[model samples]
Target: MKLFADYHTHTIYSHGTGTIMDNVNAAKKKGLKEIAITDHGLRHFTYGVKREKLKRMREEIDEINENNKDFKVLLGLECNIISSDGQIDLDDEAMKYMDIVLLGYHMMVRLKGVPSYVHIYGRHYLSKISKSMAEETRQSNTDIMINAIKKYKVNIITHPGARISMDTGRLAEAAAKTGTALEINSKSNIMTVDYLKVAAGHGAKFVINSDAHKPEDVGNFRNAIKLAEMAGLTSHQIINAVKS
Candidate 1:
Protein backbone atom coordinates (compact mmCIF):
# COMPACT_ATOMS: atom_id res chain seq x y z
CA MET A 1 0.00 0.00 0.00
CA LYS A 2 1.03 3.60 -0.60
CA LEU A 3 -0.26 6.72 1.11
CA PHE A 4 -1.20 9.69 -1.05
CA ALA A 5 -2.07 12.20 1.61
CA ASP A 6 -1.06 13.00 5.20
CA TYR A 7 -3.94 14.46 7.19
CA HIS A 8 -2.21 15.07 10.54
CA THR A 9 0.70 17.49 10.61
CA HIS A 10 1.80 20.28 12.89
CA THR A 11 3.68 23.56 12.35
CA ILE A 12 4.81 26.67 14.19
CA TYR A 13 1.15 27.42 14.69
CA SER A 14 1.26 24.81 17.44
CA HIS A 15 4.28 23.03 19.00
CA GLY A 16 5.92 22.03 15.71
CA THR A 17 9.31 23.37 14.72
CA GLY A 18 8.53 24.42 11.14
CA THR A 19 6.33 27.00 9.48
CA ILE A 20 3.25 26.02 7.41
CA MET A 21 5.03 26.72 4.13
CA ASP A 22 7.98 24.67 5.28
CA ASN A 23 5.80 21.65 5.97
CA VAL A 24 4.02 22.04 2.63
CA ASN A 25 7.35 22.15 0.84
CA ALA A 26 8.51 19.04 2.67
CA ALA A 27 5.35 17.12 1.75
CA LYS A 28 5.87 18.10 -1.89
CA LYS A 29 9.46 16.87 -1.76
CA LYS A 30 8.24 13.58 -0.34
CA GLY A 31 5.86 13.10 -3.34
CA LEU A 32 2.68 13.48 -1.33
CA LYS A 33 -0.37 14.71 -3.24
CA GLU A 34 -1.93 16.43 -0.24
CA ILE A 35 -1.32 17.36 3.42
CA ALA A 36 -3.30 18.93 6.21
CA ILE A 37 -2.18 21.63 8.59
CA THR A 38 -3.80 20.28 11.75
CA ASP A 39 -2.50 22.28 14.61
CA HIS A 40 -3.59 21.64 18.20
CA GLY A 41 -6.87 23.23 19.31
CA LEU A 42 -7.09 26.43 21.32
CA ARG A 43 -7.60 24.56 24.60
CA HIS A 44 -4.20 22.90 24.69
CA PHE A 45 -2.45 24.59 27.58
CA THR A 46 0.98 24.82 26.05
CA TYR A 47 0.74 24.49 22.25
CA GLY A 48 -2.77 25.29 21.11
CA VAL A 49 -3.19 27.46 18.03
CA LYS A 50 -4.14 31.06 18.77
CA ARG A 51 -7.76 31.90 18.03
CA GLU A 52 -6.80 35.33 16.72
CA LYS A 53 -4.55 33.83 14.08
CA LEU A 54 -7.17 31.58 12.45
CA LYS A 55 -8.06 34.14 9.78
CA ARG A 56 -4.40 34.73 8.94
CA MET A 57 -3.76 31.01 8.60
CA ARG A 58 -6.75 30.65 6.30
CA GLU A 59 -5.50 33.47 4.07
CA GLU A 60 -2.07 31.92 3.84
CA ILE A 61 -3.50 28.53 2.90
CA ASP A 62 -5.72 30.12 0.24
CA GLU A 63 -2.74 31.84 -1.30
CA ILE A 64 -0.75 28.63 -1.37
CA ASN A 65 -3.63 26.73 -2.96
CA GLU A 66 -3.94 29.43 -5.62
CA ASN A 67 -0.25 29.18 -6.46
CA ASN A 68 0.12 25.41 -6.30
CA LYS A 69 -2.33 23.59 -8.48
CA ASP A 70 -0.65 20.19 -8.31
CA PHE A 71 -0.83 19.80 -4.53
CA LYS A 72 -3.48 20.44 -1.89
CA VAL A 73 -3.25 21.63 1.71
CA LEU A 74 -6.20 21.34 4.06
CA LEU A 75 -6.62 23.61 7.05
CA GLY A 76 -7.74 21.68 10.09
CA LEU A 77 -7.45 21.41 13.87
CA GLU A 78 -6.45 18.45 16.06
CA CYS A 79 -9.08 19.40 18.60
CA ASN A 80 -9.13 18.12 22.15
CA ILE A 81 -12.01 16.38 23.92
CA ILE A 82 -12.40 18.80 26.76
CA SER A 83 -15.37 17.22 28.48
CA SER A 84 -16.79 13.80 29.26
CA ASP A 85 -20.04 14.93 27.63
CA GLY A 86 -18.27 15.05 24.23
CA GLN A 87 -17.50 18.74 24.20
CA ILE A 88 -14.53 19.69 22.06
CA ASP A 89 -12.58 22.91 21.80
CA LEU A 90 -14.15 24.00 18.53
CA ASP A 91 -17.08 26.35 18.03
CA ASP A 92 -19.27 26.87 14.95
CA GLU A 93 -17.44 30.09 14.09
CA ALA A 94 -14.09 28.33 14.24
CA MET A 95 -15.48 25.37 12.34
CA LYS A 96 -16.17 27.64 9.38
CA TYR A 97 -12.40 27.99 8.81
CA MET A 98 -11.69 24.27 8.89
CA ASP A 99 -11.58 21.87 5.97
CA ILE A 100 -11.24 18.85 8.26
CA VAL A 101 -11.38 17.97 11.95
CA LEU A 102 -9.21 15.57 13.96
CA LEU A 103 -10.11 14.86 17.56
CA GLY A 104 -8.10 13.17 20.31
CA TYR A 105 -7.65 12.87 24.07
CA HIS A 106 -4.77 14.91 25.33
CA MET A 107 -3.51 15.88 28.76
CA MET A 108 -3.14 19.47 29.98
CA VAL A 109 -6.16 20.86 28.19
CA ARG A 110 -8.45 23.50 29.65
CA LEU A 111 -11.52 21.39 30.23
CA LYS A 112 -15.17 22.43 30.47
CA GLY A 113 -15.39 22.53 34.26
CA VAL A 114 -14.63 20.69 37.49
CA PRO A 115 -16.82 17.75 36.57
CA SER A 116 -14.99 17.30 33.30
CA TYR A 117 -11.66 17.57 35.06
CA VAL A 118 -12.57 14.81 37.52
CA HIS A 119 -13.95 12.51 34.86
CA ILE A 120 -11.35 13.04 32.14
CA TYR A 121 -8.08 13.69 33.96
CA GLY A 122 -8.60 12.63 37.55
CA ARG A 123 -9.95 9.17 36.80
CA HIS A 124 -7.44 8.58 34.03
CA TYR A 125 -4.53 8.92 36.40
CA LEU A 126 -6.24 6.98 39.14
CA SER A 127 -6.69 4.02 36.85
CA LYS A 128 -2.96 3.59 36.53
CA ILE A 129 -2.72 2.86 40.25
CA SER A 130 -5.84 0.77 40.80
CA LYS A 131 -6.62 -2.37 38.88
CA SER A 132 -10.35 -2.00 39.57
CA MET A 133 -10.27 1.55 38.30
CA ALA A 134 -8.54 0.47 35.09
CA GLU A 135 -11.50 -1.38 33.61
CA GLU A 136 -13.98 1.26 34.65
CA THR A 137 -11.79 4.07 33.37
CA ARG A 138 -11.29 2.24 30.09
CA GLN A 139 -15.05 1.91 29.67
CA SER A 140 -15.58 5.55 30.52
CA ASN A 141 -12.90 6.60 28.09
CA THR A 142 -14.41 4.54 25.31
CA ASP A 143 -17.90 5.85 26.04
CA ILE A 144 -16.71 9.43 26.04
CA MET A 145 -14.93 8.93 22.73
CA ILE A 146 -18.02 7.31 21.25
CA ASN A 147 -20.05 10.29 22.37
CA ALA A 148 -17.63 12.59 20.57
CA ILE A 149 -17.84 10.55 17.37
CA LYS A 150 -21.62 10.67 17.47
CA LYS A 151 -21.73 14.37 18.31
CA TYR A 152 -19.34 15.70 15.66
CA LYS A 153 -18.41 15.24 12.05
CA VAL A 154 -14.95 14.07 13.00
CA ASN A 155 -12.94 12.99 9.98
CA ILE A 156 -10.39 11.11 12.06
CA ILE A 157 -9.53 10.19 15.64
CA THR A 158 -5.83 10.73 16.08
CA HIS A 159 -3.80 8.07 17.95
CA PRO A 160 -6.77 6.36 19.57
CA GLY A 161 -4.82 4.27 22.08
CA ALA A 162 -2.10 6.73 22.83
CA ARG A 163 -1.74 8.47 26.21
CA ILE A 164 -4.86 6.73 27.51
CA SER A 165 -6.46 3.32 27.62
CA MET A 166 -9.54 2.67 25.50
CA ASP A 167 -11.68 -0.26 24.41
CA THR A 168 -10.55 -0.37 20.80
CA GLY A 169 -13.29 -2.74 19.73
CA ARG A 170 -16.07 -0.59 21.15
CA LEU A 171 -14.56 2.67 19.92
CA ALA A 172 -14.12 1.20 16.45
CA GLU A 173 -17.80 0.23 16.32
CA ALA A 174 -18.80 3.81 17.04
CA ALA A 175 -16.22 5.23 14.62
CA ALA A 176 -17.44 2.94 11.85
CA LYS A 177 -20.97 4.19 12.28
CA THR A 178 -19.85 7.80 11.89
CA GLY A 179 -17.38 7.11 9.09
CA THR A 180 -14.54 8.33 11.26
CA ALA A 181 -11.13 6.91 10.48
CA LEU A 182 -8.65 5.89 13.17
CA GLU A 183 -5.14 7.26 12.88
CA ILE A 184 -2.03 5.12 12.94
CA ASN A 185 0.41 7.65 14.27
CA SER A 186 4.02 6.98 13.32
CA LYS A 187 5.46 9.20 16.02
CA SER A 188 3.67 7.33 18.83
CA ASN A 189 4.19 3.65 19.65
CA ILE A 190 1.01 3.01 21.58
CA MET A 191 -1.14 1.48 18.84
CA THR A 192 -0.44 -2.23 18.42
CA VAL A 193 -1.26 -4.84 15.81
CA ASP A 194 -3.86 -6.48 18.06
CA TYR A 195 -5.69 -3.20 18.49
CA LEU A 196 -5.66 -2.65 14.74
CA LYS A 197 -7.04 -6.11 14.12
CA VAL A 198 -9.90 -5.54 16.54
CA ALA A 199 -10.69 -2.18 14.99
CA ALA A 200 -10.53 -3.62 11.48
CA GLY A 201 -12.86 -6.41 12.53
CA HIS A 202 -15.38 -3.73 13.40
CA GLY A 203 -15.02 -2.27 9.89
CA ALA A 204 -13.21 0.87 10.98
CA LYS A 205 -11.27 2.73 8.30
CA PHE A 206 -7.74 3.91 9.06
CA VAL A 207 -5.20 6.59 8.15
CA ILE A 208 -1.46 6.52 8.71
CA ASN A 209 0.14 9.80 9.69
CA SER A 210 3.62 10.90 10.67
CA ASP A 211 2.16 13.25 13.30
CA ALA A 212 5.03 15.31 12.00
CA HIS A 213 6.36 18.03 14.28
CA LYS A 214 9.01 19.04 11.79
CA PRO A 215 9.05 19.75 8.08
CA GLU A 216 11.41 16.90 7.23
CA ASP A 217 9.06 14.35 8.77
CA VAL A 218 5.94 15.52 6.94
CA GLY A 219 5.24 12.35 4.97
CA ASN A 220 7.10 9.76 7.03
CA PHE A 221 4.91 6.66 7.31
CA ARG A 222 7.40 3.82 7.68
CA ASN A 223 6.43 2.77 11.21
CA ALA A 224 2.71 3.10 10.62
CA ILE A 225 2.94 1.16 7.37
CA LYS A 226 4.70 -1.67 9.15
CA LEU A 227 1.99 -1.88 11.80
CA ALA A 228 -0.77 -1.79 9.19
CA GLU A 229 0.91 -4.61 7.29
CA MET A 230 1.19 -6.68 10.43
CA ALA A 231 -2.48 -6.15 11.10
CA GLY A 232 -3.29 -7.37 7.55
CA LEU A 233 -4.76 -4.06 6.53
CA THR A 234 -5.43 -3.45 2.83
CA SER A 235 -5.47 -0.20 0.91
CA HIS A 236 -9.22 -0.41 0.83
CA GLN A 237 -9.30 -0.20 4.61
CA ILE A 238 -7.07 2.82 4.81
CA ILE A 239 -8.46 6.19 3.81
CA ASN A 240 -5.12 7.54 2.59
CA ALA A 241 -3.67 4.38 1.09
CA VAL A 242 -3.77 3.09 -2.46
CA LYS A 243 -2.56 -0.05 -4.21
CA SER A 244 1.11 0.34 -5.00
Candidate 2:
Protein backbone atom coordinates (compact mmCIF):
# COMPACT_ATOMS: atom_id res chain seq x y z
CA MET A 1 0.00 0.00 0.00
CA LYS A 2 1.08 3.59 -0.59
CA LEU A 3 0.10 7.00 0.68
CA PHE A 4 -1.74 9.36 -1.69
CA ALA A 5 -1.06 12.27 0.64
CA ASP A 6 1.02 12.44 3.77
CA TYR A 7 -0.79 14.69 6.26
CA HIS A 8 1.64 14.72 9.19
CA THR A 9 5.30 15.71 9.01
CA HIS A 10 7.78 17.99 10.77
CA THR A 11 10.67 20.21 9.70
CA ILE A 12 13.36 22.49 11.16
CA TYR A 13 10.57 24.61 12.56
CA SER A 14 10.18 21.77 15.05
CA HIS A 15 12.46 18.77 15.81
CA GLY A 16 12.83 17.58 12.24
CA THR A 17 16.16 17.78 10.42
CA GLY A 18 14.78 19.01 7.07
CA THR A 19 13.40 22.39 6.01
CA ILE A 20 9.87 22.90 4.64
CA MET A 21 11.11 23.03 1.06
CA ASP A 22 13.24 19.96 1.66
CA ASN A 23 10.19 17.87 2.59
CA VAL A 24 8.25 19.27 -0.32
CA ASN A 25 11.13 18.46 -2.63
CA ALA A 26 11.30 14.91 -1.33
CA ALA A 27 7.56 14.47 -1.85
CA LYS A 28 7.83 15.85 -5.35
CA LYS A 29 10.66 13.46 -6.09
CA LYS A 30 8.48 10.60 -4.86
CA GLY A 31 5.65 11.89 -7.12
CA LEU A 32 3.19 12.29 -4.30
CA LYS A 33 -0.10 14.09 -4.88
CA GLU A 34 0.09 16.16 -1.68
CA ILE A 35 2.07 16.71 1.54
CA ALA A 36 1.32 18.68 4.67
CA ILE A 37 3.91 20.60 6.69
CA THR A 38 2.56 19.89 10.18
CA ASP A 39 5.11 21.14 12.64
CA HIS A 40 4.54 20.73 16.35
CA GLY A 41 2.17 23.23 17.93
CA LEU A 42 3.23 26.08 20.24
CA ARG A 43 2.64 24.05 23.41
CA HIS A 44 5.60 21.77 22.66
CA PHE A 45 8.34 23.41 24.73
CA THR A 46 11.32 22.40 22.64
CA TYR A 47 10.10 21.62 19.10
CA GLY A 48 7.00 23.74 18.60
CA VAL A 49 6.94 26.48 15.97
CA LYS A 50 7.46 30.03 17.17
CA ARG A 51 4.58 32.47 16.66
CA GLU A 52 6.74 34.75 14.48
CA LYS A 53 7.61 31.92 12.11
CA LEU A 54 4.05 31.53 10.77
CA LYS A 55 4.46 34.34 8.24
CA ARG A 56 7.61 32.75 6.80
CA MET A 57 5.93 29.35 6.73
CA ARG A 58 2.92 30.68 4.85
CA GLU A 59 5.11 32.51 2.37
CA GLU A 60 7.19 29.38 1.78
CA ILE A 61 4.14 27.21 1.16
CA ASP A 62 2.68 29.77 -1.25
CA GLU A 63 5.98 30.11 -3.09
CA ILE A 64 6.34 26.33 -3.42
CA ASN A 65 2.81 26.02 -4.80
CA GLU A 66 3.29 28.95 -7.16
CA ASN A 67 6.41 27.38 -8.63
CA ASN A 68 5.12 23.82 -8.87
CA LYS A 69 1.54 23.04 -9.80
CA ASP A 70 1.95 19.26 -10.05
CA PHE A 71 2.06 18.78 -6.23
CA LYS A 72 0.21 20.61 -3.47
CA VAL A 73 1.91 21.60 -0.20
CA LEU A 74 -0.52 21.95 2.69
CA LEU A 75 0.23 24.21 5.65
CA GLY A 76 -0.70 22.51 8.90
CA LEU A 77 0.26 21.91 12.53
CA GLU A 78 0.52 18.87 14.82
CA CYS A 79 -1.46 20.55 17.54
CA ASN A 80 -0.93 19.42 21.12
CA ILE A 81 -3.74 18.36 23.38
CA ILE A 82 -2.75 20.71 26.19
CA SER A 83 -5.37 20.28 28.89
CA SER A 84 -7.38 17.49 30.48
CA ASP A 85 -10.27 19.81 29.79
CA GLY A 86 -9.84 18.98 26.07
CA GLN A 87 -8.16 22.27 25.27
CA ILE A 88 -5.87 22.18 22.23
CA ASP A 89 -3.02 24.64 21.71
CA LEU A 90 -4.08 25.76 18.22
CA ASP A 91 -6.85 28.34 18.22
CA ASP A 92 -9.36 29.14 15.45
CA GLU A 93 -7.55 32.36 14.51
CA ALA A 94 -4.25 30.56 14.09
CA MET A 95 -5.90 27.63 12.35
CA LYS A 96 -7.61 29.80 9.74
CA TYR A 97 -4.38 29.74 7.74
CA MET A 98 -4.15 25.96 7.88
CA ASP A 99 -5.21 23.68 5.05
CA ILE A 100 -5.19 20.63 7.31
CA VAL A 101 -5.36 20.24 11.09
CA LEU A 102 -3.84 17.32 13.05
CA LEU A 103 -4.01 16.56 16.77
CA GLY A 104 -1.59 14.39 18.73
CA TYR A 105 -0.56 13.69 22.30
CA HIS A 106 3.00 14.54 23.26
CA MET A 107 4.75 14.20 26.60
CA MET A 108 6.61 17.54 26.48
CA VAL A 109 3.67 19.90 26.05
CA ARG A 110 3.18 22.93 28.34
CA LEU A 111 -0.19 22.36 29.93
CA LYS A 112 -0.85 25.76 31.54
CA GLY A 113 2.34 25.65 33.70
CA VAL A 114 5.79 24.11 34.18
CA PRO A 115 4.82 21.81 37.02
CA SER A 116 1.87 20.45 35.11
CA TYR A 117 4.06 19.83 32.11
CA VAL A 118 6.66 18.09 34.23
CA HIS A 119 3.99 15.98 35.86
CA ILE A 120 2.74 14.85 32.47
CA TYR A 121 6.20 13.95 31.25
CA GLY A 122 7.14 12.25 34.50
CA ARG A 123 4.02 10.10 34.48
CA HIS A 124 4.09 8.96 30.85
CA TYR A 125 7.84 8.77 30.34
CA LEU A 126 8.53 6.57 33.35
CA SER A 127 9.94 3.11 32.69
CA LYS A 128 6.95 1.38 34.27
CA ILE A 129 3.29 2.33 34.19
CA SER A 130 0.85 0.59 36.54
CA LYS A 131 -2.26 -1.03 35.06
CA SER A 132 -4.67 1.14 37.04
CA MET A 133 -2.81 4.33 36.23
CA ALA A 134 -2.59 3.29 32.60
CA GLU A 135 -6.32 2.57 32.53
CA GLU A 136 -7.12 5.95 34.05
CA THR A 137 -4.83 7.64 31.62
CA ARG A 138 -6.45 5.70 28.82
CA GLN A 139 -9.94 6.96 29.65
CA SER A 140 -8.72 10.53 30.02
CA ASN A 141 -6.84 10.32 26.76
CA THR A 142 -9.85 8.92 24.96
CA ASP A 143 -12.01 11.73 26.29
CA ILE A 144 -9.54 14.30 25.05
CA MET A 145 -9.40 12.65 21.62
CA ILE A 146 -13.19 12.58 21.34
CA ASN A 147 -13.43 16.19 22.46
CA ALA A 148 -10.86 17.38 19.95
CA ILE A 149 -12.70 15.63 17.11
CA LYS A 150 -16.00 17.10 18.26
CA LYS A 151 -14.67 20.63 18.73
CA TYR A 152 -12.63 20.97 15.56
CA LYS A 153 -12.85 19.78 11.99
CA VAL A 154 -9.74 17.69 12.53
CA ASN A 155 -8.59 15.86 9.39
CA ILE A 156 -6.57 13.32 11.29
CA ILE A 157 -5.72 12.21 14.82
CA THR A 158 -1.95 11.73 14.48
CA HIS A 159 -1.29 8.80 16.83
CA PRO A 160 -3.83 7.95 19.45
CA GLY A 161 -2.37 5.94 22.36
CA ALA A 162 1.07 6.50 20.87
CA ARG A 163 2.29 7.86 24.21
CA ILE A 164 -0.66 7.92 26.59
CA SER A 165 -2.92 4.83 26.59
CA MET A 166 -6.46 5.28 25.28
CA ASP A 167 -9.61 3.23 24.87
CA THR A 168 -9.43 2.55 21.15
CA GLY A 169 -12.99 1.29 20.75
CA ARG A 170 -14.51 4.57 21.90
CA LEU A 171 -11.93 6.54 19.99
CA ALA A 172 -12.79 4.60 16.83
CA GLU A 173 -16.45 5.26 17.46
CA ALA A 174 -15.82 8.98 17.68
CA ALA A 175 -13.56 9.02 14.66
CA ALA A 176 -16.16 7.17 12.63
CA LYS A 177 -18.93 9.46 13.86
CA THR A 178 -17.00 12.60 13.08
CA GLY A 179 -15.67 11.49 9.67
CA THR A 180 -12.16 11.95 11.06
CA ALA A 181 -9.64 9.32 10.00
CA LEU A 182 -7.69 7.33 12.58
CA GLU A 183 -4.01 7.36 11.72
CA ILE A 184 -1.74 4.36 11.42
CA ASN A 185 1.33 6.37 12.38
CA SER A 186 4.71 5.33 11.00
CA LYS A 187 6.81 7.05 13.68
CA SER A 188 5.25 5.38 16.73
CA ASN A 189 4.12 1.74 16.98
CA ILE A 190 2.10 2.02 20.16
CA MET A 191 -1.19 1.24 18.46
CA THR A 192 -1.37 -2.51 18.95
CA VAL A 193 -3.03 -5.26 16.91
CA ASP A 194 -5.66 -5.55 19.63
CA TYR A 195 -6.29 -1.81 19.44
CA LEU A 196 -6.58 -1.97 15.67
CA LYS A 197 -8.94 -4.92 15.90
CA VAL A 198 -11.24 -3.01 18.20
CA ALA A 199 -11.03 0.06 16.00
CA ALA A 200 -11.74 -1.91 12.83
CA GLY A 201 -14.75 -3.55 14.42
CA HIS A 202 -16.23 -0.11 14.97
CA GLY A 203 -16.09 0.68 11.25
CA ALA A 204 -13.42 3.33 11.63
CA LYS A 205 -11.61 4.53 8.53
CA PHE A 206 -7.83 4.81 8.73
CA VAL A 207 -5.10 6.95 7.16
CA ILE A 208 -1.50 5.82 6.95
CA ASN A 209 0.84 8.75 7.44
CA SER A 210 4.64 8.62 7.40
CA ASP A 211 4.82 11.06 10.29
CA ALA A 212 8.21 11.57 8.69
CA HIS A 213 10.78 13.79 10.33
CA LYS A 214 13.29 13.51 7.50
CA PRO A 215 12.69 14.32 3.88
CA GLU A 216 13.56 10.94 2.35
CA ASP A 217 11.12 9.06 4.59
CA VAL A 218 8.10 10.90 3.16
CA GLY A 219 6.36 7.86 1.55
CA ASN A 220 7.49 5.20 4.03
CA PHE A 221 4.27 3.44 4.93
CA ARG A 222 5.77 0.04 5.67
CA ASN A 223 5.19 -0.08 9.41
CA ALA A 224 1.65 1.21 9.14
CA ILE A 225 0.78 -1.31 6.42
CA LYS A 226 2.21 -4.14 8.53
CA LEU A 227 0.15 -3.08 11.52
CA ALA A 228 -3.01 -2.83 9.48
CA GLU A 229 -2.49 -6.34 8.16
CA MET A 230 -2.27 -7.62 11.72
CA ALA A 231 -5.60 -6.00 12.43
CA GLY A 232 -7.24 -7.74 9.44
CA LEU A 233 -7.83 -4.40 7.75
CA THR A 234 -8.48 -4.22 4.01
CA SER A 235 -7.48 -1.56 1.48
CA HIS A 236 -11.05 -0.26 1.46
CA GLN A 237 -10.64 0.65 5.12
CA ILE A 238 -7.48 2.73 4.57
CA ILE A 239 -8.05 5.92 2.62
CA ASN A 240 -4.60 6.37 1.08
CA ALA A 241 -3.86 2.69 0.63
CA VAL A 242 -6.79 2.30 -1.75
CA LYS A 243 -4.86 3.81 -4.63
CA SER A 244 -1.78 1.75 -3.84
lDDT of 1 at 103: 95
lDDT of each: 0.94, 0.83
1-244: candidate 1 lDDT, tens digit per residue:
7899999999999999999899999999999999999999999999999999899999999999999999999999999999989889999999999999999989989999999999989999999899999999999999999998899899999999788788888999999999999999999998999999999999999999999999999999999999999999999999999765
Q: Which TM-score value belongs to model 1?
A: 0.98
Residue 92 Cα positional deviation in candidate 1, in Å, after optimal superposition? 0.3
Off by over 4 Å in 1: none
Q: List the residue pairs that clash in candidate 2.
A: none
In candidate 2, stretches whose alpha carbon ends up further than 4 angstroms from where it belongs are: 113-130
Model 1 lowest lDDT segment of ten: 235-244
lDDT of 2 by residue, 1-244 (tens): 5557788888999989999989988887876788899999988889989977987899999999999877889999998888665778888678767888888888777797565454455555542456556666667668877987898888888888777767888999999999888999987888889988888888899988999999989878888889998888888888776453
TM-score of candidate 2 on Cα atoms, chains taken together? 0.90
